[model samples]
Structures are given as C-alpha cells and as structure tokens.
Target chain A: MTNVKVTPLTDLHRASGAKMVEFAGYLMPVSYGSILAEHRAVREQVGIFDVSHMGEFVIRGKGARRLVNDIITNDCSRLAEGALQYSVMCREDGTVVDDLLVYVVRDDQVLLVVNASNIEKDLEHVLTFDRNGADVENVSDECALLAVQGPRCRDVLTSCPLFDDVREQVERTAYYHGFSFTHGGSEILVSRTGYTGELGFEILVPSNLAVEFWEAITQAGRDYGLVPVGLGARDTLRFEASFCLFGHELNDDTSPLEVGLGWVVKLNKERFRGIETLRQEKKNGPKRALVGFELEGRNIARQGYTVLKDGVEIGKVTSGAFSPTMKKSLCMALIERSAKGTEGVYEIAIRGKTATARLTPLPFYRSRAK
Target chain B: MSFENMRFSKEHEWVQFEEGSNLVTTGITDYASGELGDIVYIEFPEVGQELKSMEPMGTIEAVKTVADIYAPLSGVVREVNTVLNDDPGIVNQSPYGEGWFVKIEMSDRSELDGLMEKHEYDRMVGKG
Candidate 1:
C-alpha cells in the first residue's frame, strides 16, 4: 500500500485525541471522541468537517465549457455563472466513473470537485478524451475544503467576523449557489451544496490558509455548539439521508437508473458517453432498483450482504447502519425490480443464518429542506 | 468493574460465576465498546436458548461496524437484559451494570476453567 497522505488538520486532530484511520489514501480522523456525539452535533446544531482530501480539477480555455458539457450528465447550459450542480461522469458502458459537483465559475472556466478515491480515474477520463482540447489541471493537493453543516450553520457563519466582507451575501445565498469571498488576497469559494441533507456551506480555500480558516470557523461557531466531526459521522449522516456513496451504492457496474439518479442525465444533450444505454434503461425502467429496508432484528445488513426473497438470492445490500436519529437499523439494497412488491419479506444472510428484513421506502430519513 | 470474582473471555465478554451457583451474568467489556465506537444495538439471545462456548450468541451493532457476541461458556440462557431494547447506548455508558447482556445457567462448572482472569484477559487485549 502507498503511504497515506496527511491533511492540513492532522496535527490539530491528533492534539484533540482523534482516532485517525486510512481512508482513500488519506490519514483522516474517523472520530474525535465519540461518533455518536459528533453525529448528533451535525443533526441538532452545527459541525465542521475537514474534507480537504476531496479532489478538484480546474478546466479553462476556449472550449472548456464544451468539454465539461460533454463529460457530465447534468445540463451545464442551464447553469448560470457561479452556480453549482451535482452530476456524474460515466464510462461507455453507462457505469459511473465518478459523481462530482460542478461549479460553473465562468463560461470558459469550470471547477469539478470529485470523490477522493476516484481522483486519478476522473483526471484520466477528462484528459483522455481531448475532443475540445481544454486545459485541465488537477490541483487536489493545493486545495483545502471545509464543510460547515447543520440547521444553525448560516447563523454561526454570519456571526463570524472573518467573513464580514461577504456576511450579507453569505446569508442571502440560495442553495446550489457559489460565490467568491476574498480573504487576505486569496479568493475562497463558498458554496451552498452539501452531502448531508441539511443547510450547509462548503468552503474551498488555498491549502496554506486552511489552519487559520479552521480556527476562525471554530471560534465563531463556539456559541452554536459546533464541533469538529470526522468521516465516521459523515458517513452515517449521508447514509441516513440516502445519498449515494461512491463505492457502496454506486460503482463501475451500477447504472444511474438503478440508483435513482436518472433525473440528472439530460437526454437532450445531443451526444455524450453512455447516452444510448442510459436512455434505453430510463425508458425500460432498468432491470434493478434500489430500495430501503429495515432489519427486524438488531443485526445490520451491511454492504455485500446478500438480500434474499423466499430464501432465494435476489439482491445485495449497498449500504446500511443503525440510524442515531431514528434509533432503527436502516439500509439500502439493490434488488431486482421484479421483486419490488414481494409480500413475503426480505432476508439477509448473516453468519450462515437468515435474518429477516422489511422492505420499506426509498430514503429512511429526509431533511426539512424542500 | 470488579473482575476479582468474574472471569473474561478472549472475545471480550465478561462472566461472573458465583460460588456454588449455576447462574452467572455476562456483559461485553469496556474495551469492546471503546473499540466499537458507539453502541447502536445489542441483539440479546432468547431466554432458555442453549449456547456453546466460543459460539456466536447474537450480535452487537455500532455506528461503523457490526460484530458478533460470542458465548463465553456453554450454558442455557436464563434471562436477557431487556433494558437494552429501549436504549442500547447504555452498553457504552455502563458496560458493567445496566449494560449486562444476559444471565445463563451453566451446564457444567468446569466451563469456567476455560475462561481467563482479569489480568490474563487484559494481557490478551494488550492493555496489561
């Protein structure tokens, strides 16, 4: 295995007694003290996360807009400048290469933020297909990101003296909108997009100023009960909201139609990778569908666990956990659409014994946001 | 917290075999809870169910991982702590008292001989 890269907040996290673990080639804190405590902080109050390991690619030059439009599933033509969009890039066979957030900085300049584990593959995908010849640069190591998320996020950010120049704009910014804020000669891009199903802001700044910015955010959020949450809570938070985790819910084998992400694929985009297959699947409603389930017993149906119907294997669990908020064991599984309305029930094979599970709705939890 | 009269297993479950008594209480160790991060669920075995030594009893679900609880000794379960059904977090807060998993009627007194003492268990966990 390669050496794990350290984030800018590594020493600070160690000082706070965080349990660090290897995740996506980065040595990141899984939790500080308690995963439950950090998870609650995000749901009830506010929490800050050091998400600097996420990769960013900058595309600019004459045909940048055309190049980006050709790559992603979301309609880039509809995006106003400074607007953010959640989209996916796919291989020719319609399987996901990576899901990313596209920040339309300008008509000819775009910033694509992708998952940390897929950075190399995403960069190669963009660079390999050089139809438009845009200057694409992967500057993941030079970027630092922080996500301030929760119900009280705006109030806490508004109270921060460090963000005074853009205080009014920050408070007024609508969801999926991003704008530049200048701090000490550097332009920090703050967006209203977040993985957690809550009102939040993701700030991208230069790596050198990350420490100072982290301290400032922490100082301002002291009155709002904000804490530094690690990736452990981050997973549970996103999972509860039914977001598609890269390797778990989504992978190179599953189509967007199977995971309920077909809405992002613009069928009228003229031409793009996997367009025909995605269109065909969308019309026929994909052979498989993703469904949410509740395990009747305390045992959780984790990833890769076989989901069965009448003792016959029909699907596999994608992601699952005991929800801290709901106090129930919830998970999402990918099953054949033909088995959708099976009244018998579902089961997960656990240690040679079959554990009963109940098929439920799509998402186990929904945020207050529309 | 008093392991003086209690015995432990390498799987991290603690057992207290009373003198000349057939019933003994069992609970997961604090070390196990700390390693699991947060206790979200504890599947208690049904009372009167027979379990074998080192065999799987049920399961312990945490936020990040799910683990199986092993029976420390061969016995028939007498009672399961129902308090954990309402709030499994109690296992993390009080692994020794209210967090106890179950009580079992030992089929054989010699089963306790296979269990480890406090210091022995601690050494096995690298905490000694």
Candidate 2:
C-alpha cells in the first residue's frame, strides 16, 4: 500500500463520498455516486473528471522535433505551434510502445502526454532514442490534469473568472490545439481534447494548484448540472466513443495498423521507428483487424473472452461494456483478418456459453465534439 | 418482513425464511449493491432450477464490472422478480425491499443453522 500513489484531488474525491479503487497503482475514484448517472451527465449536461493520473513529459533542445518525429508514428514536424497530434510510438518490430499526444510548444520544444502506467517505459524509450541528445524530462509528478466535458463545456469554462486572461483564446482554440496561461506564480496548459466523444477541454495544472483549479471549474459548472465523474464513467464514455485505450486496443504485440489507427502512421513521411514494417504491413494489410460488435442480448462480452467463427477460435475481445448511453451490450474485438468473411456475425464465449454477436460500425455513439 | 430475522451468506446474499412455510425469499445485501455501483443487468436463475448451497445462481452486471450471484442455501427457485428484467437499478436503489432476486422452496431447512447473523456478516465485511 505504501507504494501506491494518490492524485492531488484524491482527498477531495473522498470528501465528496466517491468510491475509490486502485487503478494503475493509484487509489482513484471509480464513481462519486452512480456510474450510470455520471455517464448521463456528460452526455446530456456536463461533467468534470480528475485525470491527473496521466503522464507528462517535456522534451526540449534543438533536436526535440526530430527526436519526437523519429520516435512517434505521426509527423510532429507538420504541427504548427500550439497544435497537438495523436500518435503511437512503436518498437522496430512495428508493435506499439505507447500511444500519446504530442503538443508542439515551439520548433525546438515539445510536450508528450502519455499513459500513466507507461511513464517509466515511455521515458526510457524516449531517452534511448534521443540520438541528438534532446533533453527529455518526465514532469508527471509535478503536473495534474482535469477534464471538463459536455456540449456546454465552453460555457462552463468561460464562466470561471480565473480564466479571464485566456477567455478569448479559450473560445478560439481549435480542436487539437492548446494555449498556455499563467496566474499567480504558476502556469497551466489548456487544450480542446478529450477521451469522451464530447466537446471538452483538458487543463494541465501544477500539482499544488490542482485542487483550486478543479474547485473553480466545479463552481462554474454547478449551474449547468456538472457532475463529478469518475474512472468508471470515463471508461464507458470512451468505450462508446470507440477510443483505443492503450492496454485494451494496443499493446507491445499490437500494431497501429491492426487497431485502425493507420491514419496516424504517415508512411510517406521521413523514416521513423517501425516504418519499414508498418509500410510493409500497409501494402499487404494487417494480419488482424479490430471490429465493433453488439451482443444479441444484455450479457456482456468481457475483455479477453474468446471470439469464434464457425466454431473455430478467431481472436479475443479487447474491450466490452454495457454502454449506459447506447443501452446495449457492446464490445470491440481483435479478430483474424481472414475471419472477417463471417458475414457480419460471430460467436463470443461468455461464461461457458456461446453468445451471438453481430458486427457494428466502429463508434456505437456519435461524437458531439466539434 | 423485517431483516432482523434474515440470515446472510458470506457471499453477501440475504435469505429470509417464512416462519410457517418452507418458502424463502432472497436477494443481495445492501452492502453488495453499494459495492457494485450501478447495476445495469441481472441474469436471474430460471424458475424450478435447482440451486446448491454457496453455488453460482446468476449474474449481476454493473457498469464497471460483473459478478456472480451465489445461492445462500440449497433450494429450488420458485419465482424470480421479473421486474428486474427492465429495471436492474432497483437493486441499487432498494436492495432489501423491491430488489429481492428470487423466492425459493428450501431443500434443507437445516442449512439455516450454518448461516451468519447480520452483525457477524457486517463484521466480516468490515462494516461493523
């Protein structure tokens, strides 16, 4: 227990009657009240999440852009200052190391936001690939992240007087773009990005001021029916959106091409890690494909459940849930590419019984993010 | 119908035996419902299905996780509260009252002697 960590807002979550659980070695809130209610609040009204468990790293120096582009699949060189691009870093074998968001601060300074569980691994990967001696520092311990999400997210954000200095910029910040603002003696970064398929903003605050910033956002969101969401709702929200969570949709053995993230590969660009294999896979297609499916009934198809076609094992489930928004049992599975000819139907082995599941479109829920 | 006389299982199910009849009513405890967060679906055992003591009887699905509902004693399922078919949240809202999962005709009434009281069950779950 001594090795487990707690985010800066953990005490406040406990004070608000949140049910806490261990996730990625941190004792985080699973829900403040009901996960179903918290999920609806984000879809129908607004919600706030303490996502401070995510990792942050700042890479600076003359070789920063090159180091980033060489390590990640996306072309960071194309990003304008203040722009963010989602990308996956892979080993030479074309398997993913981590999926991250790259924030371009300047031509020579960039920030990488990574998965909390992969901080140590990602840091070591970046350092090892830093042929140009780029200064890479893990700032996760000093940073905290908060996400305010919903259709009325902008209204809720601008209502906070603390954001007066950047209210205009906040309203103008395009999707995937960010701007930094300073107050008192500290600085914060605000970006129009989120895991939920909702119009939202993620704010990177200093660890010391995380609670204060969260309180300000919560106060401003009260009139708009903002609920304090937890990790349980966070996962269901992203699952409905079909977002590829690192461990679920990707791992050291899964390539970006197989998980439907090929758009970020940018094979036409300069050589990067795993480019040779990804380029080859692009021409021949990946061996496996990720597809969305809905079960015939309410029974869930849990992660790692065996997927079968014609009574033969095809693959396994990656993520599954009873989507509160869709009101159905849904899952994403990684199946053999040859098995895609099953005529849109497959069988999922659930609790020792075969349950019928049918192929559905990628996202079961439509995004109102724009 | 007071829960004071109800016996609880180590698995967090509560069983109430009628004084004159062999019929027993059972459901998950309030602590079980609270730990499950928001229940979205429950796959109840079919009527007339035989249940063995401490064996899995059904499935309870919440938004985050799923767990098996275990039978507290040996019996045959007499009836399932079908209302839970469309409104599983009732389990989270009223775990003791309307959320009762099933009624069973006890196979061995002597099994009640091995069950725990509310206070002991609470102590086991660190609620006492």
TM-scores of all models?
A: 0.95, 0.97
Candidate 2 on A55-123: residue-level lDDT in tens?
999999999999999999989887899999999999999999999999998888899999988999998
Candidate 1 chain B — worst ten consecutive residues by lDDT sum?
B1-10
Fnat per model, in the order given?
A: 1.00, 0.93
Writing each residue's lDDT as its tens digit, candidate 1 over A253-307 gives 9898889998788878887788988888788889999999988776777899999
- Indicate the residue-level lDDT of B22 in model 1: 91
Residue A204 of model 1 has an lDDT of: 95
Q: How many backbone clashes does every candidate have?
A: 0, 0
Which segments of candidate 1 are over 4 A away from where they belong?
A131-133, A342-344
Show model 2 residue runs off by greater than 4 Å.
A131-133, A342-345
Task: Give the DockQ of candidate 2.
Answer: 0.86
What value does the lDDT take at residue A175 in candidate 1?
92
Each prediction's DockQ? 0.80, 0.86
Best by DockQ: 2
What range of 10 consecutive residues in model 1 chain A has the weakest lDDT sum?
A361-370
